[model samples]
Target: MNDRSNARKEQRKKRYQRQMARQQKGSKRYQRTRLNVARIQRYRANCIKNMAHQVSHHLVADSTTMVVALEDLSLKNMTASAKGTVDQPGKQVRQKAGLNRSILQSGWGQLRQYLLYKTFQRGKLLVFVPPHNTSQECSRCGTIDKASRRHQSGFACTACGFTDNADRNAARVIARHAAYGLIRNKQPGQELSTVTLRPIPY
Candidate 1:
Protein backbone atom coordinates (compact mmCIF):
# COMPACT_ATOMS: atom_id res chain seq x y z
CA MET A 1 0.00 0.00 0.00
CA ASN A 2 2.84 2.37 0.80
CA ASP A 3 4.59 1.62 -2.52
CA ARG A 4 1.28 2.00 -4.41
CA SER A 5 0.67 5.39 -2.81
CA ASN A 6 4.20 6.52 -3.65
CA ALA A 7 3.72 5.50 -7.29
CA ARG A 8 0.48 7.46 -7.52
CA LYS A 9 2.13 10.53 -6.11
CA GLU A 10 5.02 10.18 -8.55
CA GLN A 11 2.65 9.82 -11.45
CA ARG A 12 0.70 12.91 -10.45
CA LYS A 13 3.90 14.88 -10.03
CA LYS A 14 5.06 13.89 -13.51
CA ARG A 15 1.67 14.84 -14.98
CA TYR A 16 1.80 18.27 -13.39
CA GLN A 17 5.33 18.77 -14.66
CA ARG A 18 4.19 17.98 -18.19
CA GLN A 19 1.29 20.40 -17.89
CA MET A 20 3.54 23.20 -16.65
CA ALA A 21 6.11 22.48 -19.35
CA ARG A 22 3.45 22.89 -22.04
CA GLN A 23 2.77 26.42 -20.81
CA GLN A 24 6.40 27.54 -20.98
CA LYS A 25 7.43 30.44 -23.19
CA GLY A 26 10.25 30.48 -25.69
CA SER A 27 13.72 31.78 -24.78
CA LYS A 28 14.61 35.48 -24.64
CA ARG A 29 16.38 35.08 -27.96
CA TYR A 30 12.96 34.25 -29.36
CA GLN A 31 11.45 37.49 -28.09
CA ARG A 32 9.78 37.90 -31.48
CA THR A 33 8.12 34.50 -31.08
CA ARG A 34 4.84 36.26 -30.41
CA LEU A 35 5.09 37.99 -33.78
CA ASN A 36 5.42 34.68 -35.57
CA VAL A 37 2.49 33.35 -33.59
CA ALA A 38 0.46 36.44 -34.34
CA ARG A 39 1.11 36.09 -38.06
CA ILE A 40 -0.10 32.52 -37.97
CA GLN A 41 -3.16 33.57 -35.99
CA ARG A 42 -3.86 36.31 -38.56
CA TYR A 43 -3.60 33.77 -41.35
CA ARG A 44 -6.05 31.48 -39.62
CA ALA A 45 -8.43 34.36 -38.98
CA ASN A 46 -8.34 35.35 -42.65
CA CYS A 47 -8.96 31.81 -43.79
CA ILE A 48 -11.93 31.40 -41.48
CA LYS A 49 -13.23 34.85 -42.41
CA ASN A 50 -13.02 34.04 -46.12
CA MET A 51 -14.82 30.78 -45.57
CA ALA A 52 -17.56 32.55 -43.61
CA HIS A 53 -17.89 35.14 -46.36
CA GLN A 54 -18.14 32.46 -49.01
CA VAL A 55 -20.72 30.50 -47.08
CA SER A 56 -22.77 33.55 -46.12
CA HIS A 57 -22.65 34.96 -49.66
CA HIS A 58 -23.59 31.63 -51.19
CA LEU A 59 -26.55 31.19 -48.88
CA VAL A 60 -27.80 34.74 -49.38
CA ALA A 61 -27.16 35.18 -53.13
CA ASP A 62 -29.29 32.16 -54.04
CA SER A 63 -32.36 33.25 -52.10
CA THR A 64 -34.76 36.13 -52.52
CA THR A 65 -35.29 38.31 -49.42
CA MET A 66 -32.34 36.70 -47.74
CA VAL A 67 -31.55 37.65 -44.18
CA VAL A 68 -28.34 36.49 -42.54
CA ALA A 69 -29.17 36.06 -38.90
CA LEU A 70 -26.13 35.95 -36.63
CA GLU A 71 -25.31 36.33 -32.95
CA ASP A 72 -24.32 39.57 -31.32
CA LEU A 73 -21.93 37.95 -28.82
CA SER A 74 -20.71 40.25 -26.11
CA LEU A 75 -16.98 40.67 -26.63
CA LYS A 76 -16.53 41.00 -22.91
CA ASN A 77 -18.20 37.68 -22.21
CA MET A 78 -16.47 36.12 -25.19
CA THR A 79 -13.08 36.92 -23.73
CA ALA A 80 -14.10 35.61 -20.35
CA SER A 81 -15.56 32.37 -21.69
CA ALA A 82 -12.43 31.90 -23.76
CA LYS A 83 -10.36 31.96 -20.60
CA GLY A 84 -12.40 29.85 -18.19
CA THR A 85 -16.01 29.37 -17.21
CA VAL A 86 -16.77 31.32 -14.05
CA ASP A 87 -17.68 28.34 -11.89
CA GLN A 88 -15.85 25.26 -13.07
CA PRO A 89 -12.37 23.89 -12.34
CA GLY A 90 -12.80 21.44 -15.19
CA LYS A 91 -12.85 24.41 -17.51
CA GLN A 92 -9.41 25.38 -16.30
CA VAL A 93 -8.27 21.82 -16.85
CA ARG A 94 -9.81 21.96 -20.32
CA GLN A 95 -7.90 25.19 -20.90
CA LYS A 96 -4.73 23.34 -20.01
CA ALA A 97 -5.81 20.74 -22.55
CA GLY A 98 -5.90 23.31 -25.42
CA LEU A 99 -9.60 24.27 -25.68
CA ASN A 100 -9.13 27.79 -24.35
CA ARG A 101 -6.66 29.06 -26.96
CA SER A 102 -8.85 27.85 -29.80
CA ILE A 103 -11.65 30.01 -28.50
CA LEU A 104 -9.35 33.01 -28.41
CA GLN A 105 -7.82 32.22 -31.80
CA SER A 106 -11.21 31.73 -33.50
CA GLY A 107 -11.76 35.48 -34.00
CA TRP A 108 -15.53 35.14 -34.31
CA GLY A 109 -16.07 38.88 -34.43
CA GLN A 110 -13.66 39.21 -37.34
CA LEU A 111 -15.45 36.46 -39.23
CA ARG A 112 -18.74 38.26 -38.63
CA GLN A 113 -17.24 41.46 -39.96
CA TYR A 114 -16.13 39.75 -43.14
CA LEU A 115 -19.49 38.08 -43.52
CA LEU A 116 -21.30 41.36 -43.04
CA TYR A 117 -19.55 43.09 -45.95
CA LYS A 118 -19.81 40.06 -48.19
CA THR A 119 -23.54 39.75 -47.57
CA PHE A 120 -23.99 43.41 -48.41
CA GLN A 121 -22.07 42.96 -51.66
CA ARG A 122 -24.57 40.30 -52.67
CA GLY A 123 -27.42 42.64 -51.82
CA LYS A 124 -28.46 40.65 -48.79
CA LEU A 125 -29.15 41.93 -45.31
CA LEU A 126 -27.06 40.55 -42.47
CA VAL A 127 -28.68 40.75 -39.09
CA PHE A 128 -27.15 40.42 -35.63
CA VAL A 129 -29.32 39.11 -32.79
CA PRO A 130 -28.78 39.28 -29.07
CA PRO A 131 -27.44 35.95 -27.81
CA HIS A 132 -29.19 35.28 -24.55
CA ASN A 133 -30.50 31.72 -24.51
CA THR A 134 -29.90 30.72 -28.09
CA SER A 135 -28.57 27.36 -27.05
CA GLN A 136 -31.20 26.67 -24.44
CA GLU A 137 -34.32 27.92 -26.25
CA CYS A 138 -36.08 25.37 -28.35
CA SER A 139 -37.01 26.67 -31.78
CA ARG A 140 -39.86 24.22 -32.35
CA CYS A 141 -41.50 24.71 -28.96
CA GLY A 142 -40.02 27.87 -27.45
CA THR A 143 -38.65 26.10 -24.39
CA ILE A 144 -36.02 28.05 -22.51
CA ASP A 145 -33.90 26.23 -19.94
CA LYS A 146 -30.33 25.08 -19.39
CA ALA A 147 -31.09 21.37 -19.47
CA SER A 148 -32.42 21.47 -23.02
CA ARG A 149 -29.01 21.09 -24.57
CA ARG A 150 -27.26 17.76 -24.48
CA HIS A 151 -24.12 19.23 -25.94
CA GLN A 152 -22.94 22.18 -27.96
CA SER A 153 -24.56 20.74 -31.07
CA GLY A 154 -27.69 19.14 -29.69
CA PHE A 155 -30.78 20.70 -28.14
CA ALA A 156 -33.54 18.67 -26.52
CA CYS A 157 -36.39 20.60 -24.97
CA THR A 158 -38.40 19.35 -22.04
CA ALA A 159 -41.31 21.75 -22.38
CA CYS A 160 -42.37 20.37 -25.75
CA GLY A 161 -39.83 17.58 -26.21
CA PHE A 162 -38.43 19.38 -29.22
CA THR A 163 -35.10 18.03 -30.34
CA ASP A 164 -32.96 19.75 -32.94
CA ASN A 165 -29.40 20.39 -33.88
CA ALA A 166 -27.93 23.01 -31.52
CA ASP A 167 -26.48 25.20 -34.25
CA ARG A 168 -29.76 25.07 -36.16
CA ASN A 169 -31.67 25.99 -33.03
CA ALA A 170 -29.34 28.90 -32.44
CA ALA A 171 -29.89 30.06 -36.00
CA ARG A 172 -33.62 29.90 -35.46
CA VAL A 173 -33.35 31.93 -32.26
CA ILE A 174 -31.14 34.42 -34.08
CA ALA A 175 -33.75 34.74 -36.80
CA ARG A 176 -36.34 35.43 -34.13
CA HIS A 177 -34.08 38.08 -32.67
CA ALA A 178 -33.49 39.56 -36.12
CA ALA A 179 -37.23 39.97 -36.51
CA TYR A 180 -37.14 41.96 -33.30
CA GLY A 181 -34.87 44.61 -34.92
CA LEU A 182 -31.90 43.77 -32.76
CA ILE A 183 -29.44 44.32 -35.57
CA ARG A 184 -30.65 47.84 -36.14
CA ASN A 185 -30.52 48.90 -32.53
CA LYS A 186 -27.07 49.65 -31.18
CA GLN A 187 -25.95 49.38 -27.61
CA PRO A 188 -25.22 52.90 -26.37
CA GLY A 189 -21.62 52.89 -27.64
CA GLN A 190 -20.85 50.04 -29.97
CA GLU A 191 -19.19 50.38 -33.36
CA LEU A 192 -21.35 47.64 -34.81
CA SER A 193 -24.31 49.77 -33.79
CA THR A 194 -22.94 52.43 -36.14
CA VAL A 195 -22.37 50.04 -39.03
CA THR A 196 -23.94 50.79 -42.41
CA LEU A 197 -23.60 49.20 -45.78
CA ARG A 198 -21.96 50.95 -48.72
CA PRO A 199 -23.46 50.59 -52.21
CA ILE A 200 -22.59 47.25 -53.69
CA PRO A 201 -20.19 47.41 -56.57
CA TYR A 202 -21.90 46.94 -59.88
Candidate 2:
Protein backbone atom coordinates (compact mmCIF):
# COMPACT_ATOMS: atom_id res chain seq x y z
CA MET A 1 0.00 0.00 0.00
CA ASN A 2 1.07 3.63 -0.54
CA ASP A 3 2.25 5.68 2.46
CA ARG A 4 -1.02 7.70 2.71
CA SER A 5 -3.27 4.62 2.48
CA ASN A 6 -1.07 2.79 5.01
CA ALA A 7 -1.38 5.72 7.49
CA ARG A 8 -5.18 5.84 7.11
CA LYS A 9 -5.48 2.12 7.70
CA GLU A 10 -3.30 2.40 10.80
CA GLN A 11 -5.53 5.18 12.20
CA ARG A 12 -8.70 3.10 11.67
CA LYS A 13 -7.00 0.05 13.19
CA LYS A 14 -6.09 2.10 16.29
CA ARG A 15 -9.63 3.47 16.58
CA TYR A 16 -11.31 0.07 16.34
CA GLN A 17 -8.79 -1.34 18.82
CA ARG A 18 -9.50 1.52 21.30
CA GLN A 19 -13.25 1.04 20.94
CA MET A 20 -12.86 -2.62 21.72
CA ALA A 21 -10.66 -1.86 24.73
CA ARG A 22 -13.27 0.58 26.03
CA GLN A 23 -15.88 -2.10 25.66
CA GLN A 24 -13.68 -4.51 27.60
CA LYS A 25 -12.62 -2.25 30.48
CA GLY A 26 -16.14 -1.04 31.34
CA SER A 27 -14.54 1.63 33.50
CA LYS A 28 -15.33 5.14 34.72
CA ARG A 29 -13.96 6.79 31.55
CA TYR A 30 -16.28 4.69 29.49
CA GLN A 31 -19.23 5.64 31.69
CA ARG A 32 -18.27 9.32 31.61
CA THR A 33 -17.97 9.31 27.83
CA ARG A 34 -21.37 7.70 27.54
CA LEU A 35 -22.79 10.39 29.82
CA ASN A 36 -21.20 13.08 27.69
CA VAL A 37 -22.64 11.47 24.57
CA ALA A 38 -26.08 11.72 26.22
CA ARG A 39 -25.73 15.49 26.19
CA ILE A 40 -26.82 15.49 22.54
CA GLN A 41 -30.05 13.81 23.63
CA ARG A 42 -30.59 16.38 26.36
CA TYR A 43 -30.17 19.34 24.02
CA ARG A 44 -32.52 17.83 21.42
CA ALA A 45 -35.10 17.19 24.15
CA ASN A 46 -35.04 20.83 25.26
CA CYS A 47 -35.58 22.02 21.69
CA ILE A 48 -38.58 19.74 21.20
CA LYS A 49 -40.27 21.15 24.35
CA ASN A 50 -39.75 24.72 23.20
CA MET A 51 -41.24 24.09 19.75
CA ALA A 52 -44.20 22.16 21.17
CA HIS A 53 -44.93 25.08 23.47
CA GLN A 54 -44.83 27.59 20.65
CA VAL A 55 -46.98 25.49 18.32
CA SER A 56 -49.49 24.39 20.95
CA HIS A 57 -49.76 27.89 22.38
CA HIS A 58 -50.52 29.29 18.94
CA LEU A 59 -53.05 26.53 18.27
CA VAL A 60 -54.85 27.08 21.59
CA ALA A 61 -54.91 30.88 21.24
CA ASP A 62 -56.24 30.77 17.68
CA SER A 63 -58.85 28.07 18.21
CA THR A 64 -62.37 28.68 19.49
CA THR A 65 -62.29 25.79 21.93
CA MET A 66 -59.94 26.35 24.85
CA VAL A 67 -59.39 22.67 25.50
CA VAL A 68 -55.94 21.54 24.35
CA ALA A 69 -55.51 17.83 23.75
CA LEU A 70 -52.14 16.10 23.61
CA GLU A 71 -51.15 12.58 22.63
CA ASP A 72 -49.37 10.52 25.27
CA LEU A 73 -46.10 9.55 23.64
CA SER A 74 -44.35 8.40 26.80
CA LEU A 75 -44.38 4.92 25.35
CA LYS A 76 -42.97 5.64 21.94
CA ASN A 77 -43.35 3.11 19.13
CA MET A 78 -43.08 4.77 15.70
CA THR A 79 -40.25 7.28 15.56
CA ALA A 80 -37.78 4.67 16.76
CA SER A 81 -38.35 2.74 13.54
CA ALA A 82 -36.82 5.39 11.23
CA LYS A 83 -33.42 3.88 10.56
CA GLY A 84 -31.95 3.22 7.12
CA THR A 85 -28.62 3.74 5.45
CA VAL A 86 -27.07 3.48 2.02
CA ASP A 87 -24.04 1.34 1.26
CA GLN A 88 -20.77 3.00 2.17
CA PRO A 89 -17.26 1.65 2.84
CA GLY A 90 -14.18 2.51 4.93
CA LYS A 91 -15.80 5.26 7.05
CA GLN A 92 -17.29 5.77 10.48
CA VAL A 93 -20.93 5.25 9.54
CA ARG A 94 -23.31 6.70 12.11
CA GLN A 95 -27.01 5.93 11.76
CA LYS A 96 -27.95 9.46 12.78
CA ALA A 97 -25.31 11.06 10.61
CA GLY A 98 -27.39 12.25 7.63
CA LEU A 99 -30.63 12.68 9.54
CA ASN A 100 -32.36 16.08 9.60
CA ARG A 101 -31.06 16.43 13.15
CA SER A 102 -32.17 20.02 13.54
CA ILE A 103 -35.77 19.40 12.52
CA LEU A 104 -36.10 16.38 14.80
CA GLN A 105 -34.22 18.25 17.52
CA SER A 106 -36.97 20.90 17.82
CA GLY A 107 -38.17 19.21 21.05
CA TRP A 108 -41.75 17.94 21.25
CA GLY A 109 -41.50 17.61 25.03
CA GLN A 110 -40.52 21.26 25.40
CA LEU A 111 -43.41 22.22 23.13
CA ARG A 112 -45.79 20.24 25.33
CA GLN A 113 -44.46 22.01 28.39
CA TYR A 114 -45.06 25.36 26.71
CA LEU A 115 -48.61 24.31 25.86
CA LEU A 116 -49.34 23.27 29.44
CA TYR A 117 -48.05 26.52 30.89
CA LYS A 118 -49.72 28.69 28.27
CA THR A 119 -53.07 26.96 28.76
CA PHE A 120 -52.80 27.36 32.50
CA GLN A 121 -51.79 30.99 32.06
CA ARG A 122 -54.80 31.53 29.82
CA GLY A 123 -57.12 29.61 32.18
CA LYS A 124 -57.80 26.92 29.61
CA LEU A 125 -57.99 23.17 29.98
CA LEU A 126 -55.30 20.86 28.54
CA VAL A 127 -55.82 17.13 28.44
CA PHE A 128 -53.95 13.96 27.42
CA VAL A 129 -55.28 10.56 26.41
CA PRO A 130 -53.87 7.29 25.10
CA PRO A 131 -52.44 7.56 21.57
CA HIS A 132 -53.63 4.19 20.22
CA ASN A 133 -56.07 4.20 17.24
CA THR A 134 -55.88 8.00 16.91
CA SER A 135 -54.19 7.72 13.53
CA GLN A 136 -56.20 4.67 12.53
CA GLU A 137 -59.62 5.87 13.76
CA CYS A 138 -61.82 8.02 11.53
CA SER A 139 -62.36 11.53 12.84
CA ARG A 140 -65.79 12.02 11.29
CA CYS A 141 -67.40 8.66 12.06
CA GLY A 142 -65.14 7.37 14.87
CA THR A 143 -63.94 4.33 12.95
CA ILE A 144 -60.87 2.37 14.05
CA ASP A 145 -58.91 0.07 11.77
CA LYS A 146 -55.36 -1.13 11.37
CA ALA A 147 -55.59 -0.59 7.60
CA SER A 148 -56.66 3.04 7.87
CA ARG A 149 -53.12 4.30 7.56
CA ARG A 150 -52.53 3.90 3.83
CA HIS A 151 -49.20 5.65 4.23
CA GLN A 152 -47.11 7.31 6.90
CA SER A 153 -48.21 10.94 6.38
CA GLY A 154 -51.93 10.35 5.80
CA PHE A 155 -55.01 8.61 7.14
CA ALA A 156 -58.00 7.37 5.09
CA CYS A 157 -60.89 5.46 6.65
CA THR A 158 -62.21 2.52 4.66
CA ALA A 159 -65.36 2.06 6.75
CA CYS A 160 -66.73 5.62 6.71
CA GLY A 161 -64.80 7.14 3.79
CA PHE A 162 -63.44 9.86 6.11
CA THR A 163 -60.12 11.45 5.34
CA ASP A 164 -57.83 13.88 7.20
CA ASN A 165 -54.42 14.52 8.68
CA ALA A 166 -53.05 11.81 10.97
CA ASP A 167 -52.18 14.21 13.75
CA ARG A 168 -55.59 15.90 13.46
CA ASN A 169 -57.33 12.55 13.67
CA ALA A 170 -55.39 11.72 16.84
CA ALA A 171 -56.08 15.19 18.23
CA ARG A 172 -59.83 14.73 17.68
CA VAL A 173 -59.75 11.41 19.50
CA ILE A 174 -57.86 13.00 22.41
CA ALA A 175 -60.48 15.74 22.51
CA ARG A 176 -63.30 13.22 22.58
CA HIS A 177 -61.62 11.30 25.39
CA ALA A 178 -61.12 14.58 27.28
CA ALA A 179 -64.76 15.57 26.86
CA TYR A 180 -65.93 12.21 28.10
CA GLY A 181 -63.90 12.81 31.24
CA LEU A 182 -65.48 16.24 31.80
CA ILE A 183 -69.06 14.95 31.57
CA ARG A 184 -68.37 12.15 34.04
CA ASN A 185 -65.41 11.38 36.24
CA LYS A 186 -64.81 8.15 34.29
CA GLN A 187 -63.88 8.38 30.62
CA PRO A 188 -65.67 6.16 28.12
CA GLY A 189 -64.11 2.72 27.82
CA GLN A 190 -66.01 1.41 24.79
CA GLU A 191 -64.39 1.13 21.39
CA LEU A 192 -65.08 3.71 18.61
CA SER A 193 -67.41 2.67 15.79
CA THR A 194 -67.53 4.02 12.24
CA VAL A 195 -71.22 3.66 11.43
CA THR A 196 -72.46 4.27 14.96
CA LEU A 197 -70.36 6.19 17.49
CA ARG A 198 -71.62 5.06 20.87
CA PRO A 199 -69.95 6.94 23.77
CA ILE A 200 -70.05 10.60 22.74
CA PRO A 201 -72.00 10.41 19.48
CA TYR A 202 -69.39 11.62 17.04
Candidate 3:
Protein backbone atom coordinates (compact mmCIF):
# COMPACT_ATOMS: atom_id res chain seq x y z
CA MET A 1 0.00 0.00 0.00
CA ASN A 2 2.75 2.46 0.94
CA ASP A 3 4.79 1.55 -2.10
CA ARG A 4 1.86 2.16 -4.42
CA SER A 5 1.12 5.46 -2.79
CA ASN A 6 4.73 6.56 -3.03
CA ALA A 7 4.89 5.60 -6.70
CA ARG A 8 1.74 7.54 -7.46
CA LYS A 9 3.13 10.53 -5.56
CA GLU A 10 6.31 10.43 -7.64
CA GLN A 11 4.32 10.21 -10.87
CA ARG A 12 2.23 13.18 -9.84
CA LYS A 13 5.30 15.22 -9.01
CA LYS A 14 6.87 14.51 -12.38
CA ARG A 15 3.67 15.30 -14.24
CA TYR A 16 3.34 18.58 -12.36
CA GLN A 17 6.89 19.61 -13.16
CA ARG A 18 6.44 18.76 -16.84
CA GLN A 19 3.22 20.75 -16.98
CA MET A 20 4.87 23.76 -15.42
CA ALA A 21 7.80 23.63 -17.80
CA ARG A 22 6.06 22.90 -21.08
CA GLN A 23 2.68 24.59 -20.81
CA GLN A 24 1.97 28.32 -20.68
CA LYS A 25 -0.17 29.56 -17.78
CA GLY A 26 -3.90 29.93 -18.63
CA SER A 27 -3.44 27.98 -21.87
CA LYS A 28 -5.64 24.98 -22.72
CA ARG A 29 -2.79 22.52 -22.13
CA TYR A 30 -2.01 24.12 -18.78
CA GLN A 31 -5.65 23.97 -17.72
CA ARG A 32 -5.91 20.33 -18.77
CA THR A 33 -2.82 19.33 -16.78
CA ARG A 34 -4.07 21.29 -13.77
CA LEU A 35 -7.35 19.41 -13.86
CA ASN A 36 -5.49 16.12 -14.10
CA VAL A 37 -3.42 16.99 -11.03
CA ALA A 38 -6.53 17.98 -9.13
CA ARG A 39 -8.25 14.75 -10.17
CA ILE A 40 -5.37 12.64 -8.90
CA GLN A 41 -5.34 14.52 -5.60
CA ARG A 42 -9.09 14.17 -5.20
CA TYR A 43 -8.91 10.45 -5.94
CA ARG A 44 -6.26 9.90 -3.29
CA ALA A 45 -8.27 11.87 -0.73
CA ASN A 46 -11.46 9.93 -1.50
CA CYS A 47 -9.62 6.64 -1.12
CA ILE A 48 -8.40 7.62 2.32
CA LYS A 49 -11.86 8.85 3.33
CA ASN A 50 -13.54 5.67 2.13
CA MET A 51 -11.09 3.48 4.02
CA ALA A 52 -11.62 5.48 7.17
CA HIS A 53 -15.40 5.15 6.85
CA GLN A 54 -15.20 1.40 6.36
CA VAL A 55 -12.92 0.90 9.36
CA SER A 56 -14.99 3.11 11.64
CA HIS A 57 -18.20 1.43 10.50
CA HIS A 58 -16.87 -2.02 11.26
CA LEU A 59 -15.71 -0.99 14.75
CA VAL A 60 -19.02 0.64 15.58
CA ALA A 61 -21.06 -2.21 14.11
CA ASP A 62 -19.57 -4.81 16.43
CA SER A 63 -22.44 -6.13 18.53
CA THR A 64 -20.44 -6.65 21.73
CA THR A 65 -18.65 -3.34 21.65
CA MET A 66 -20.38 -0.56 23.54
CA VAL A 67 -17.38 1.66 24.22
CA VAL A 68 -14.45 2.64 22.04
CA ALA A 69 -11.23 3.97 23.49
CA LEU A 70 -8.60 5.87 21.52
CA GLU A 71 -5.42 7.70 22.29
CA ASP A 72 -5.82 11.45 22.26
CA LEU A 73 -3.05 11.89 19.73
CA SER A 74 -1.81 15.36 19.01
CA LEU A 75 -0.75 15.00 15.39
CA LYS A 76 0.46 18.57 15.13
CA ASN A 77 2.95 18.02 17.91
CA MET A 78 3.90 14.57 16.68
CA THR A 79 4.59 15.84 13.14
CA ALA A 80 6.17 19.13 14.06
CA SER A 81 9.15 20.16 11.94
CA ALA A 82 12.41 19.16 13.52
CA LYS A 83 14.42 21.84 11.71
CA GLY A 84 15.73 24.50 14.07
CA THR A 85 17.21 27.96 13.54
CA VAL A 86 20.84 28.52 12.55
CA ASP A 87 21.81 29.03 16.18
CA GLN A 88 20.83 25.50 17.15
CA PRO A 89 20.15 23.08 14.30
CA GLY A 90 17.97 20.09 15.11
CA LYS A 91 19.42 16.60 15.02
CA GLN A 92 17.98 13.86 12.78
CA VAL A 93 16.12 16.34 10.60
CA ARG A 94 15.97 13.96 7.63
CA GLN A 95 14.67 11.06 9.72
CA LYS A 96 12.09 13.25 11.42
CA ALA A 97 10.88 14.57 8.05
CA GLY A 98 10.41 11.05 6.76
CA LEU A 99 8.49 10.07 9.88
CA ASN A 100 6.31 13.17 9.54
CA ARG A 101 5.46 12.25 5.95
CA SER A 102 4.51 8.73 6.98
CA ILE A 103 2.32 9.99 9.80
CA LEU A 104 0.51 12.48 7.57
CA GLN A 105 0.01 9.91 4.82
CA SER A 106 -1.50 7.39 7.25
CA GLY A 107 -4.61 9.59 7.61
CA TRP A 108 -4.85 9.07 11.37
CA GLY A 109 -6.75 12.32 11.96
CA GLN A 110 -9.27 11.39 9.29
CA LEU A 111 -9.82 7.96 10.83
CA ARG A 112 -10.27 9.49 14.27
CA GLN A 113 -12.81 11.99 12.94
CA TYR A 114 -14.77 9.21 11.25
CA LEU A 115 -14.72 7.12 14.43
CA LEU A 116 -15.90 10.04 16.53
CA TYR A 117 -18.96 10.77 14.36
CA LYS A 118 -19.85 7.11 13.84
CA THR A 119 -19.67 6.36 17.57
CA PHE A 120 -21.88 9.33 18.33
CA GLN A 121 -24.38 8.37 15.68
CA ARG A 122 -24.57 4.82 17.04
CA GLY A 123 -25.10 6.00 20.59
CA LYS A 124 -21.85 4.46 21.80
CA LEU A 125 -19.17 5.82 24.06
CA LEU A 126 -15.91 7.09 22.54
CA VAL A 127 -13.23 7.76 25.09
CA PHE A 128 -9.80 9.27 24.46
CA VAL A 129 -7.03 8.29 26.85
CA PRO A 130 -3.66 9.84 27.46
CA PRO A 131 -0.97 8.18 25.33
CA HIS A 132 1.94 8.38 27.74
CA ASN A 133 3.89 5.20 28.49
CA THR A 134 1.19 2.93 27.08
CA SER A 135 3.61 0.76 25.10
CA GLN A 136 6.04 0.47 28.04
CA GLU A 137 3.35 -0.49 30.57
CA CYS A 138 2.52 -4.15 31.00
CA SER A 139 -1.15 -5.02 30.65
CA ARG A 140 -0.92 -8.22 32.69
CA CYS A 141 1.07 -6.91 35.63
CA GLY A 142 0.48 -3.15 35.32
CA THR A 143 4.20 -2.60 35.49
CA ILE A 144 5.53 0.59 33.93
CA ASP A 145 9.08 -0.34 33.09
CA LYS A 146 10.61 1.18 29.97
CA ALA A 147 13.02 -1.70 29.61
CA SER A 148 10.10 -4.07 28.99
CA ARG A 149 9.71 -2.53 25.53
CA ARG A 150 12.87 -4.08 24.17
CA HIS A 151 11.77 -4.13 20.55
CA GLN A 152 9.44 -2.27 18.20
CA SER A 153 6.89 -5.07 17.91
CA GLY A 154 7.57 -7.13 21.05
CA PHE A 155 6.78 -6.26 24.65
CA ALA A 156 7.91 -8.30 27.65
CA CYS A 157 7.09 -7.37 31.18
CA THR A 158 10.23 -7.13 33.32
CA ALA A 159 8.35 -7.55 36.58
CA CYS A 160 6.02 -10.46 35.75
CA GLY A 161 7.65 -11.99 32.66
CA PHE A 162 4.47 -11.44 30.64
CA THR A 163 4.94 -11.17 26.88
CA ASP A 164 2.69 -9.80 24.16
CA ASN A 165 2.71 -7.77 20.98
CA ALA A 166 3.71 -4.20 21.75
CA ASP A 167 0.72 -2.70 19.98
CA ARG A 168 -1.75 -5.09 21.59
CA ASN A 169 -0.29 -4.49 25.03
CA ALA A 170 -0.64 -0.76 24.56
CA ALA A 171 -4.24 -1.23 23.51
CA ARG A 172 -4.90 -3.33 26.58
CA VAL A 173 -3.42 -0.62 28.77
CA ILE A 174 -5.78 1.91 27.20
CA ALA A 175 -8.71 -0.40 27.81
CA ARG A 176 -7.74 -0.80 31.47
CA HIS A 177 -7.51 2.95 31.88
CA ALA A 178 -10.94 3.44 30.38
CA ALA A 179 -12.45 0.59 32.37
CA TYR A 180 -11.08 1.93 35.64
CA GLY A 181 -12.32 5.47 34.91
CA LEU A 182 -8.88 6.76 35.68
CA ILE A 183 -9.34 9.94 33.72
CA ARG A 184 -13.01 10.63 34.27
CA ASN A 185 -13.95 14.30 34.35
CA LYS A 186 -10.33 15.18 33.70
CA GLN A 187 -9.50 17.93 31.24
CA PRO A 188 -7.35 17.34 28.18
CA GLY A 189 -3.60 17.31 28.89
CA GLN A 190 -4.27 16.56 32.57
CA GLU A 191 -1.94 13.96 34.03
CA LEU A 192 -3.28 10.61 35.15
CA SER A 193 -2.81 9.59 38.75
CA THR A 194 0.36 7.75 39.77
CA VAL A 195 -1.50 5.11 41.76
CA THR A 196 -0.86 1.54 40.80
CA LEU A 197 -3.53 0.21 38.45
CA ARG A 198 -4.89 -3.29 38.86
CA PRO A 199 -4.31 -5.79 36.10
CA ILE A 200 -7.43 -6.39 34.05
CA PRO A 201 -8.49 -10.00 33.68
CA TYR A 202 -8.78 -11.20 30.13
Task: Give the whole-model CA lDDT for all candidates, comma-separated.
Answer: 0.61, 0.58, 0.76
Off by over 4 Å in 2: 1-50, 75-104, 186-202
* Model 2: per-residue Cα lDDT at residue 146: 80
Model 3 over residues 1-202: C-alpha lDDT tens digits? 3568657775986778697679999998888888877777777677677767777777788766777777777888876656655776688777788877665665778878988898899887787778889879999989999999989789999999999988789888988877677457667999754433222111
Residue-level lDDT tens digits of model 1 in 1-202: 1335435644655554554456556655343444544554465556656655665555556555456666776666655555555476454565444543443345456557776787778776777666788778887777789988867668889899878777777777767767557445657776542323221110
Candidate no. 1 TM-score: 0.58
Show the lowest summed lDDT stretch of 10 residues, model 3.
193-202
What residue pairs are clashing in model 1?
Answer: none
lDDT, candidate 2, 1-202, per-residue tens:
1336435644655565566566646777766555554554464455456556557656667545466666665423334333333544324324333233322444454556676788788877667767677768787788789898887668888998788777667667767766665555644795532221111111
- On lDDT, the leading prediction is 3
- Total clashing pairs in model 2: 12
Model 1 residue 130 distance off true place after TM-score fit, in angstroms? 0.7
* Model 3 CA lDDT for position 123: 81
RMSD of each: 11.7, 12.4, 6.4
| Best of the candidates, TM-score | 3
Instruction: Order the candidates by lDDT, highest first.
Output: 3, 1, 2
**Residue 152 in candidate 3, Cα distance off native in Å:** 2.8
